[model samples]
Target: MFKYRWVFIIVPFLMFLEGCRENFDYRDASGELLFSKDTVYLDTVFNSLSSSTYSFKVYNTSNDDIRIPSVYLKAGADSGFRLNVNGNSGQAFSDVEISANDSIFVFVESTFDLDTLSSPSFLATDAVVFGNIDTQQEVALVTLVRDAIFLFPQRENGITESLPIGVDENGEPVSIEGFVLQDDQLTFTNNRPYVIYGYAAVPAGKVLEIQEGSRVYFHEASGILVQQGASLHVLGSKSNDTEVMEKEVIFEGDRLEPEFSDIPGQWGTIWLAAGSTNNRLEHLTVKNAVIGLFAEGDPQLTPPKTTIVNSRFLNSANINILARNTSFYARNTIAGSAGQVSVFLAEGGNYELLHCTIANFWNQGPRSLPALLISNYTETSFGERSTSPLTKAQFTNNIISGNAGIEMLFDRDEQEAFNILFRNSILQFDTNNSDLLQNPLYDFTDGNIYEEILLNSDPEFVRDAPDPFQLSSSSPAINIGTADFISEAREDILGNLRDQTPDAGAYEFQGN
Candidate 1:
């Protein structure tokens, strides 16, 4: 009788323990699954090019472990959209589980063929459908698909050779097997965008004239090379007041996705060979490249190697304007946000920047260089330095500022003549040191050399908005420029006329 009493007590305790376990609720509801985003827009992908993977999350807000009865693409197996639901890649998935208060990821990718479509450019769209008992939801997928003229290095006999770029640090000519533009291919109209696979070289005596509103996209390590005696003329006009998109010539990476828009070092440099001359750029925008402009001109030439006006260079990995033993003239130009120096005048050069802005606020990485660097000597591969004369380095009504303490570095060899002049410009150099302030390099006391310069004062820029380089209303640069400096062209970069006493830098100060 005692044993029977103990068994009954244990059975009751076991029943109580079973009742203490938590219960799960699996009722189907319309809003049971929460999505990270309602839509996913992929980049403008070329024909036959694989797109980058885009992902979204599906969260189970319900208290129970919810099992999605079906997850599939609305377009089914023949659709361009490929879906991977919780690690399983297929047209459809069944019984996809998400634990209570947990989430699962769904990745999508696509590869489109333009020949399959009836148009040159089209919008590819589909939908990711999720279903359960009496409930359904969807997330839209959209991508811009285009047919582009892809240029790549031709392979012969199973060997891919490159074109001759230039001299290396050892003073040796380096050659890579790249595609050389033929005489017929020199002119690029406002047709569909050209996607370059390797470096594109304009042969000697050829001219590559890009018309207005032409878009040129370069692949990784690909750029345009103006060979010796070749010319590059980019003729772009200011956008119409009523037009939504600017008519400026654009040079950027081939990737049109949002993530890679601001990424630097996407392509190589636009290199002007040693003897390349008569190159001009107007109303152009070059961004996300290794180097925006690399001009190596023959020092013997009298006229400027290249002339740029009303152009902008943004997000270069290294120097935006790298001129070596060259002559370049720029007006109403803005160049900045480089990994190293924004404008590097190395091995001596002749440069005149008028009403231009050279500022480097590169927050992408650790930048040790300045915004403007002028060096008369270049280090060779043998650790020896070769000195070149900096005939004329002039900055008038320009703004030279950056994150560095000293935004301008003038490394002059004692023997070589370093002729540099900063007139009516706002310089971001520390003047706290009495000795530095007194020095002619920092101070503009010498009438014949420097004059009317503002040192170490903030220009009060409008930082990282639509126009980051524009001067605010309270900027010290306003009404501080020499009226006679910009006498020829009364208009600033934005087509705004300068006042009697103009503001400095590329822009005229319109009220806040």
Candidate 2:
């Protein structure tokens, strides 16, 4: 009887070991389906016709070994788009294998048009709906588009060309490249989107002026870095603003979440290095940068000045403007949501904010993360004694709102200290409305120094104000400016004269 029982148990155990070595069970695969991007905006330049490229990764999430002979990509009910891989034919994809939790990526370049709206088609019809026996899956893509368009007017050079010039086999500018730009001052008559991949350096020895209504685009890890001693004059109006749009403009390669440090210093920064003095930036919008403008150079007694008038700094990881011994006269500038501090000055530099709006800095709580700090220190010696030899900043007449952690913190030591002068600025404590969580009027260490003059009320904004930051006629910021403190050529971001008695923060109320 004992011998018979052992034989039965041993035979079953041998059978179970054989089953464990077999292929993965088809019913056990379960992976979530997700799309690469949430929104896709179609610019009107292409006339409702567009094509983008993308890649898809399929993963197997089960304990058993699974097989995917072929994978099929289908968009919409009628199979509007398809992908062919390595000379294999299959409406149902195959030629694959997966062990428990393995995956595969399928690269696809799909073209779709919105010519028929009533019969409306999907931007990305159901991708990867067919084929594949096991494991839940997902699809992702890499979008592609044209970067630039050139337009030329009829001149003595006998040239007449428009935007969207067809490209030749080499993907170079076919029409505009040959036109000889004889005049030192030339105009690009084109009105289309021009994409910039790497550093788009303009011509040397001549000023490059972009007319209003011109749109420029930049790819990932790319930006416009004006070298030392260069000038860029951007002419834009509210109605027809000259736009510089960047899709994947990443300044530092270290901040892409879920996949940190994919490419360190993959792209250089927008360096407005020394000799970039007296350059004016007006009515421009800069987005998605590691550091918006990192200006550095030796200081002069009558220092070099860079003025940012009526421009915006949005969605950057580091300082919007990092000046080292460079003086900046920023007026009516709007800064929104910095991963670190909005403005960082170092080593005997000066910055003046007149009628400017700084919102949403250090939106994330300060816990080892970069807070919205204005410092006179370097990266290596941060939180330590101040090695920076500079006077305090002059933050006069500005509206600073929406900071999560420490709002405007100043750091320095006795021999190397920096102070803040908020003569007539409104520091609205609107973060969560819980006055306790809001940043203090002044966040200064025992050895630091600063000053502020807070009015007892919020400066009421006017109805449908031109800028959301404008002060109403009845607000407290009107007729409260200090003329002696501001710069002589100081102008608001809107090009308005800064002449309030005790200047209200960052704007000159129209009626007042």
The top-ranked prediction according to TM-score is 1
Candidate 1: lDDT of 498? Answer: 92
How close to the true structure is residue 301 of candidate 1, measured as C-alpha lDDT? 68
Write one digit per residue (lDDT tens) for candidate 2, span 306-374. 777777766566656667866777766777666665666766566677766665535344423232355
Question: 96 in model 1: Cα distance from truth in Å?
Answer: 3.9
Please write out the lDDT profile of model 1 over residues 117-183, one tens digit for every residue. Answer: 6676899999998986468899999998987777789888998758866678768998865789987
Each prediction's whole-model lDDT (CA): 0.86, 0.51
What TM-score would candidate 1 get against the native?
A: 0.87
